[model samples]
Target: MSPTTTFQDLQAAFPHWTIWRSSADRLWATRNQRLTDAQLSHGLSHTIDADDADQLVAQLRNQEKLATGLLPQ
Candidate 1:
């Protein structure tokens, strides 16, 4: 079965980034109507795996923190 994550879940976790899944079971993220560097480096698509989801969450959180200066550069 394809792994699924709801928009609500991701919205609650990282409201700063847009999140969604592709028809082919790939996860995607974007900020300011553009793909993140991580997304670009990893490719625009990701397999629906728990590890990939976790990493995406982490990257989004970091992006949020960096934007808000919560984390030092």
Candidate 2:
């Protein structure tokens, strides 16, 4: 079995973000909408990349927390 989540699975799980894999095999995600200034100040970004889908998911979850003020900026 594949160790990483499929692109379709990630997209389905995170409808707010666009997910894809790079030519170099990195997993990448970008928000569908721009982040607010407050979110930017909190270190949120419009795009994120990871070595694998699992890592990308973790980063996305952290981004969600930051965007929602669940975690300290």
Task: Please provide TM-scores, in order, for all candidate models, with all chains considered together.
Answer: 0.49, 0.82
Candidate 1 residue-wise lDDT, 1-73, digit = tens = 1257566788677565567766766566765345456655643322222235766676675555445532223
Clashes of 2: 0
Candidate 2 on 39-69: residue-level lDDT in tens? 7888889999999777888899888877775
* lDDT values, one for every candidate: 0.54, 0.80
Q: Per-residue lDDT for 40 in model 1?
A: 50
Q: Worst ten-residue run, lDDT, model 1? A: 42-51
